[model samples]
Target: MSIVRNIGAEYQPGKGTAFTVWAPKATQVELSLKSNPQTRVPLQREAFGYWTGLSEEAVPGTRYMYHLDGERDRPDPASRFQPEGVHGPSAVVDHTSFGWTDATWQGLPLDQLIIYELHVGTFSAAGTFEGVIEHLPELQDLGITAIEIMPIAQFPGSRNWGYDGVFPFAAQNSYGGPEGLKKLVNACHGHGISVVLDVVYNHMGPEGNYLNEYGHYFTHRYNTPWGDALNFDDAHCDHVRNFFIQNTLTWLRDFHIDALRLDAVHAIYDTGAKHFLQELREHVGQLEEQEGRPFLLIAESDQSDVRLINPINKGGYGLHAQWFDDYHHVIHTLVTGEMEGYFEDYGKPDQLQKALEHTFVYNGLYSEHRKKTLGTDATANPARQFVVCAQNHDQVGNRMLGERLTELVPFEMLKTVAGMILLSPYVPMLFMGEEYGEQNPFLYFVSHTDTDLVEAVRKGRKEEFAYFAAKGEAPDPQSEETFERSKLRRSYTSDPQQQKLREFYKALIQLRKTHPALAHPDKPHLRVKLDSEKLVLHLTHTGQEPHLYCLFNISNQPQKTQLHAAAGPWKPLLHSADTAWGGPGADIPEMLQQRATVSLPPASVLILELFA
Candidate 1:
């Protein structure tokens, strides 16, 4: 059956509103309004375990809840606006009321997407969706084409990473509800920036999750890190699948979201003939055809399975792109020289070269961390199919103190890391405050009302960071101070060094957009060579005219390397070690000949354009 779009309270202009909810477990369900609790309307139970009713008095501003079997009152499973909190009544939202200014915005192609991921609360001082809109101009000026926002679904409190969202449809009350989110999306499109929302579909948050009371939303057949897994393959799973599919459509159709970044797809266990991702992709494709615009699905998976991004006709899930952490792992380990937990599987200089040429370094190889063969060869996939980054929420926030790369690495190494990520043949993403050197930590935090649940979260965080126990005790996840500390200081303009770093990032972004070799992801014509002894990486992009030669010196000492370029004069394009960029000095000559020996400065990167 086709998916239903109007699952919750859908308001009609002249003809009141219609409410539909899935409640298979309840024999009787009544709609109770929050404004007047005495007024109750009984809904008729429809086939396939759904309740439907129409209320003339239930206006757009009316807040309501579903009373099941005259026993319990719970918020709608598909709430659009949770004004009070996750535990409060859901408000009726008039999606048509908001006037959007982006009618001409179609969307950006995968090749042209330079994503900047940010958390709405920490991104701005106001800590609301409108607050994020305030910085759209600054982001556009930085050459960002899209912003991948962390999950904003209705979680418990105002301060959170947003992964514990319980209401799939409702926008968080603290971050400014549904209307606030719409305004931000509308503003983003107006600025020619596509919005990619991070969504959690594997499991609901433990605190205010009421889906189990409505129907068989979770199953014991499989287990996830959050206990019972979503019922994607179990019995009575069609309705549950429809619930999520409708949520996807609501965002794309109603909210005008350009894409969705599915958080942690590895935790989603579905063994059906048609996997949940495939079904969701099919629905999204149908919407794309109807809307005449592009809609993308980017998955975050640790499996490194090519099937996730492979075409459905080729026996795969057919997702557009995925977060490729192998590249980040190799780069982080090489720069930090710290091998703990999953970092044990990385750190070889050859692996960095492999990740640049090929997508994955552990393709069908036994992983020292997993103790088993993991991943498939991803060389067949296009480079744009992988979204790589130097640092992200998981890479930074997962640390004991949530220290960013700026705090972990030196100033020169920071420039080198930016060069490696932006110049590589893939879609590049930058975490918030990464453009400049924001020193504040992006720690894990939560604000659950249940004392026991809060304690459990604190204990889980401590155990998660057991590898870094010697770094001192982790900050309390339930503390408001932790969330406050994660906020960006926005000191790039005031701080001279940070301003220089920001300029360097802008220059790299411009190069990525304008340079022939960096503009396109021609993996077949890209060649990579690594010297583990000298800690130097040489990359040649020969796909386009006037081939480009790149060098990265990751060592602390300068290394002399031979430039194996074509028999022509090569002009220096961008040198990270140039004195103009706060580096010591440029050691390479102004003009380079073929097979010329040049000194590469310590912790520096150089890009040269070959001229025939």
Candidate 2:
């Protein structure tokens, strides 16, 4: 943690700003204030490639850059705000200047998190952090405890999915800078909504990348899908690791971020005694102990490893939770009946049941997709350790057409799928506009300044989906229209059909909060039974206070099953086939008798409260 000391520009109001940079390779480093070559402030070169200097001329709002070896100038790698974009000089931002009102806002527990993931560029009409503030009340009303915002780091251009961000510490200039982010976080805390930021630590973007000139930031020993992995275990990697650790602290301490969703943890290749992930977790734990507030770390890991969410005492990385893709794959294939690519292992009723009973369907089992046995036992993990979603940015945007669940499946089936996710024991996350059934496609859009890189991205998009016969031509990634097309239409919720879907989602979320069986995170209490031939799923809950019986007809045809229960009658809590949810009508009785035959309509979900 001491490695972060004297790094980046620290500005004071009455005093001046102190500039420090880690240019270990450079013989000499100079500070250029206001991007003016005339005012070159000489920095005292210290040991370990660090240079420090104090300048009265450099103040808050002043744009500056580091002149390495008295030659080429590069933006500060630890810049707090990049007001002029990623390629331009970094601005000196005083984080203490923001009058935040969330001093007493202790974050919610991981189990209570109903995460709503939204992109700052596409969530609101203004497409800024301030624009997202206006919609806080709606999310608060929707039972969302945490708002997991997509990456807002400084990217090459205005429009991007944010994966191409190079400046990890700075906020995107087009979507408002550091001050804008603070304002949004303060506003969210005021609305009782905790903020979770998505951060990419695996690799930096190709364009506007200047870390290589400073130190050995990347390692060629291992490569990621995006680029070369960060050098976490290599030589002189102490400061390199501290660079990201300080970034996390800046969000948690300065910006009052409640949690971090680590982007693609599987890509962060590190083979060391103490992994970078574990170090990050320990640092966060120390902060939590000092602040007496719960700060969580969530990982987006595709490896299906339980060690990510396991406790440190249990020999694991100790992250709070991870994104569970198996839940999505099973539900997607079961509802839509699409068995392509990774969806091949899923489509069966037994698979869905397995996913329900256990967190991972392929826990130590052979995966047909990977052509090898994938995952380990995660049955011991609590449900809250997993964040499940039917539709997300990767699932929807990675497609050739970028079609959402609304565009892929029928309206009734969409409600059924929503019921499954919200009622599940695991934490639920709703992608932007998923609650209202917004029809806009979340296309992958980028605005790179480099012509060759832009053309390469366009070419790669087509080549990646060339084998899929069902998918048509993909939208041009270089086009501005593609970015605009992904923006959410808030007015869509006003439509009758869309409003009905939103109400259904709201009801399920509310029931999840109220019902013990739905809210409980214990897996042993939940029992899942599947009829593969009829595509019927019966989930019985007996562990908690409120016993529940959930039945779903995943097929497109009606199915009947005989109910065998102990004694008394069961009350109807929610029926997906009810007229209120834009369904045909109720198929099950209001109060069921023992050994009574119950019928379930096509693409319907029924949740009953046991009163025995």
Candidate 3:
């Protein structure tokens, strides 16, 4: 197996450190220590726009910057730790120094992942990497197999969403830096939970961005909503690709991250024979083989393109999975009755049924919102290849008021939605406070220092929400109050209603893991049907003995639905409207026969297990 070499300052034990950087735009590159600016070491320019040098003075914990052409100074683009925010000098870190106890961890399989997404800054009172470790026991007990953290790369300031990260290699200084992140991952592995880091390679943020001064990292050939797209297929693109590919390997090989959630892959434009994602997967596969552990590459894609997850041999970019937003749009619109933006295409009971059955409601269908056809058929993909969620960061935080599902619909409906998501065949992910229903709005917040850039962000947010029905001006994105308000109110978990909801989620997850039919996603044996008149959904899993039948009543009024199961006796497994879940009552019969008429309560869900 070939060892992967990092491009930043690599600490050599007993010796000094070897520093390498790609500075194609500079005529000369010099390393200057922050502790003593007078000390400078000139680096030798190498082939392919790279500069290399050995500096005995530059050791671990030393802060340094590159002096470009004797004119201006800038931080290392691949700095492992930005100790003093994004604008400060970069600090050298020894990757082997941290003591890790997860040598025996084999990592969780893709199908077994029950992901809980959280923002590091707002996940706890401390709002740091170490702060997240305190909640691992609770998350483990809640049956979460993995935690998908939002991006932690150093950004303009502490409060902004990680998508605005400018330094792809450095860990955010405000969130305890590189050491803090390693500790969090170590603790998670000890608790039998995997870690998935969300990384942004689509575009660099406006503030504190210095990549352009180094090399051709961005190209104007294609445009993304965020900013100039990464130069994946433009001039001098090989080095740019290597820069990101090395970044991807560094996270897995050095940091021991189990998986990476590629942010907004739909925005990645590459026309080369071998796509960037494919090359990334190839490199990850090699590393995975060397480490003898599973390393998954999941994408957050808006386009339901099967090519993203298709096998490489079949002329497709091989990926483990992609986020299924069609399910969220269908369920959110169906429950809230909101019909604006992308929600305009959903809001029907059949759409929810189609999403569950085919994995995409807009597969090869014309999108009225886009005024063109969008998405391809994803029905042939494995069920586990699609990650479904009722509410995620983008769904909640991007809203005009950042209102959670708890704030939009009735309390009883919350149970129904949880049941639908948890019991589905696809992998399920829960947002930070959604297990018990967090009430605090996850408002968009930023801490950029540039006044003009801050104003542009404020203006952009207002126009993004113009089509929505939400009234009132959006809270200031640059305000500290907005960041504080987005923090999860952990105290809410103590409330009786919240406690019951938490218990319901725990039970559903337990069942999903233990039940024969639910344990494995046997899509071939799955069936779904919708009764538009009664506003009921019927789902059946007949892959294993003791089949499962799930019924969801989305309307406010109670609805009667016929059982669609083989000849057998059906027993009540879980009912959302039961008294145990703090619902009105359990109106469904205790024992259900095949083809029997079942009465479902308003806005409730019922799961039945059949015995032959």
Best by TM-score: 1
**Compared with the true structure, what per-residue lDDT tens digits does model 1 show for residues 1-612?**
434545999999988889999989999999999888997899999988899999988899899999999988999999999888988999998888889888889999898999999999899999999999999999999899999999999999788899999999998999888888999999999898999999999888988999989999999999688989998888888899999999999999999999999999888888888989999999999999999998999999999999999999999999999999999999999999989889999999889888977789989999989999999999889999999999999889988899999988899999999989988888999999999989999999999999999999899888877777788889999999999999999998798888888888999998888877766765898888888999998888877777888899998888999887655689899898877777877766778998888798889999988976
- Number of the top-ranking candidate, with lDDT as the measure: 1
Worst 10 residues of 1 by lDDT: 1-10
Per-residue lDDT tens digits for candidate 3, residues 419-465, read 88988889999999999988999989999999999999999888777
Model 2 per-residue lDDT tens digits across residues 124-207 = 989999999989999988888889999999999899989899999998999989889999999999999989999999889999
Q: What is the lDDT of candidate 1?
A: 0.90
- Model 2 spans > 4 angstroms off: 1-6, 468-471
Clashing pairs in 3: none
RMSD per candidate (Å) reads 1.2, 1.7, 1.7
Error of 3 at 80 (Å): 0.6
Residue pairs of candidate 1 with colliding backbone atoms: none
| Top-down TM-score ranking | 1, 3, 2
TM-scores of all predicted structures: 0.98, 0.97, 0.98
lDDT of 2: 0.86
- Which of 1 and 2 is ahead in TM-score? 1
